[model samples]
Target: MTTASTQVVLSLTERMPTTRRYLMCEPRHFTVEYVINPWMDPTTPVSTELAVAQWTAMKETYESLGHTVETIEPVDGLPDMVFSANSGTVIDGRVLGARFRAPQRSAEADLYRRWFLDAGYRDVTMPSRVNEAEGDLAWTGQILLAGTGYRTDPAAHAEAQEALGVPVVSLQLVDPRYYHLDVALVVLTEATPTRQAHIAYYPEAFSPGTQRVLARLFPDAILATDADAACLGLNAVSDGRNVVIAQESTHLIAELRAHGYTPHPVDISELRKSGGGPKCCTMELRG
Candidate 1:
């Protein structure tokens, strides 16, 4: 290989970036799913039930921690509609309109345009397909890792990356459980793992080439134990050092604390039933 290429590869390997941070929805927006989730049932008239109370507590907790909350009216189809924080595909000043994949919330992307504009994010462009969502995109030290399986495709990720004038790698996902890359992996960058980025996980589904790519980028990766990985919001957001993991991931809680990180645990058990957690509900623009 060329000397220049080798140097570039070496430099790119295992280098972590600062953890990006972001805000969550406020009280009004937090109570969204109460109206939409029941539509999935299609039985009796849709009801908000106890979601209002849940959203209230979640909003208070988020605000108590100093995060700005976003609010919006409940749209019919997208139950995850309130997690506007999850719609986080930004570069420079541009917002990558999430390409919707799940029909249940296909309209979520439909709602992104207005949200982006209202949120003051003007430079918005969508991946080729009109269905990609914000949660599908994962940034590993500026290198975009797109997970394609049931929710997204390689072509979709390629289009988004190409348009953004960035490098991207399709991290093919093993379906049903690890729906998005964020759910299966949380990027521990210089912000969280001390300047060494780790694509934390327990899956053995990558190809040799893919494995090589990962190793070359972040070599200090820790393939987490199932318990540490799954319940603790394994693939959530972090600001290089601090993380927002699921409260259920108790062991990881100890690990992060031992490493000197100010970890925040969010109770997302209710969302888990719908294939979501911390990462799925929010996207970190600045960790």
Candidate 2:
């Protein structure tokens, strides 16, 4: 007999791949210089050289898969700049810039805001409330799924809605290890005119209410295993069909395949020392 999850997978139609534009920053200065999230540890040694090599390979993988990859220059002192997903949220050509919660990452907000303005984004709005941009905000093609209870202030949810002109659904993350919504949930197939949205998430990362909300929103959503979640497997980037994920997430990779999605695993273990994975390094540029 097929499991409920497997049955859900079998019931789904074929998935289609779309070419996406992504913004990535090279891990030139990536290191565990400070500890913020549970994954970070300053005492542990980090290899900047290895980080760069791994990041380069991930970027190349996106390009090889018919996606456009753009880069932003990395600043020396900001080691976490490599995880550009925290920079801002972009949708329909409008940009809502991030306001970091941690003082160490405060400077990144202005830099990313400047990049948006420089790129000719006239509808850019710098958020006043503490919001980590795409790190806590995810666009599901139908609505903005916002996360709080950790990095992003709940007040920012309304602010994001106003700035981006979209409906926002707020979810509270309970686990510090899954502080960011992107770390706990990955949108598998964004809602389109012909299809509803689909996602894969780690239920334990969310509060009970949030888990129930997620289930109601995505009844057929793939539930990730504990081992995969521990490896930051839910921190993935999906272009409707192909999923770029961490190489360490073996079970999640198999689940993606079973669900008719291609999983491209990249080893960013060095960057994971600072609490980031494939999705953390990629910022989608939607227009």
Candidate 3:
């Protein structure tokens, strides 16, 4: 039986039509895996129960703000399916379902296909060959930057952009640890109502290419502080003057204030542990 899908996953390209716009998504569904990253190994022990509570609270928070959310059902055998961060590359009207780079998380495509189709995304396309998940994709309206590192490849990124008929900028990752794009980058500006354009990426540490790309993207760029970047400050949603950030990311919250913006912080530690911060978990679709 086919389940009815009412939400329309929006594309960044459409949001970028103007300057700054307002866009918010309801966090109705989310998942947090049992095993955290190998690097952040904590033998202290964590519970899936606690994680779900956080996820549920996050969803409720979004609902309070007035947006609908859908639970992306888990596919058998894939533990990470609970985390719908690695799903697709959405821009304009195209919703390109992703192919996972991690062999363990590859089953997400078969699971997510229904959501895209049911949402009325007809221009869906896949790589003729093979590719990584869309979580590795960074959409900035004008340029779709793909991280060519652990979770993504040249071919996969190229295929995604081609399918969408858009130009892509490949950010070569020297640090193998920050493999997935979301870990290192997030589009900070999607505040516009009609056209939701992002502020692009700002590497807190330092990256000349990163700065150049951002400078080129926005004429009057809002430089988010490095302290905020450390706390995933750069990974936030901006509604013009209002900004929503992760609770644990302290530096980002302060930086947001310095730049003259009201910051709304919520606990997203569970989401971060599962390889998604704030931006990864959402695909904005407003017609």
Candidate 4:
């Protein structure tokens, strides 16, 4: 790992020229109320107060760094609403809505749509197939990396490409633990004209074919260990330079610093019990 004094640290503006905007939700009624994914276990208890405090801290962190942060009202019986990244994908000033696989989260589709429309996202694209939106789809600065074989259907990738007018690369997720693409992959920066950015991901979470695809596309990408993946460390949010991640993911943080990226660790342990961290609670609003 690179030592603090020797590390090359880039300011947010130098790394990302555009102001990063995000949408988040308050953990007002957040809980493991239903078991929709492997991470959720309703039998376990959840501290709503702690979840709120952690989420508020995350929002403030973004604002403190000169980024824009917006909020969506949390609805009752929608515990997973706190994970706003699943709501939809915003690209090129358009919102591509999500079609949740589970009925427990199906209502979220409409809730997100209403917010998008009211927020002046007139070019909203609704999907005919099942898609979890940004939860499985993320921009790598050059292309859209879409995940399937779990929460999002393979067909949704085609729809996303058409709706967003961008090239889409489909990667198959084999591990149930990393059900969402965002859980296994962390895009370091969007590709710019002068430079190609990189990503950090857990190869074990993907199928062999998808792993090979990633290895081929990103030969110099960072690889997360099983321990780090289990801590949901790969599920991170980066503004090209500074990365906000789970405080417990020390190894990953060291790796990021070694790669000249500053890691901002936050204690979202309460939210991690529900299988989420900084990235899960944040949805980059490109539109």
Ranking by lDDT: 2, 4, 1, 3
lDDT of each: 0.57, 0.92, 0.56, 0.87
| TM-score-based ranking | 2, 4, 1, 3
Query: Which one wins by lDDT: 1 or 3?
Result: 1
- The residue-by-residue lDDT of candidate 2 on 1-287, one tens digit each, is 89978765764556888899999999998889888899998999999999999999999999999999988999999999999999889999999999999999999989988888888889999889999999999998898999998899999999999999999999999999999999999998999898899899999989999999999999989999999899999999999888999999999999888888989999978989999999999999999
lDDT of 1 by residue, 1-287 (tens): 56866754554453423423354442232223332221122333322443444445555555556565555556654566656544557665656776565455666665766766887776677666642445566666567777766567677776777666667877766534555666666766632334444556545435456667666776766566677655635845565545667788877777665444557777665555444566655645431
Residue range 39-109, candidate 3, lDDT tens digits: 23334444556556655665555555555655665554554565455666667777677676556666677
Winner by lDDT: 2
Q: Candidate 4 — worst ten consecutive residues by lDDT sum?
A: 5-14
RMSD for each of the candidates:
7.7, 2.3, 9.9, 2.7
lDDT of 4 by residue, 1-287 (tens): 76555444532224553469999999998988777678888888789999999999888888877799999999999988998998889987888998999999899889989999899889999899999988899898789999998889999999999999999999999999899999899998778898786899999999999999999999989899988899899888898878888887888898887777778888888888788888889989985
**Best candidate according to TM-score:** 2
Q: All candidates' TM-scores?
A: 0.74, 0.96, 0.73, 0.94
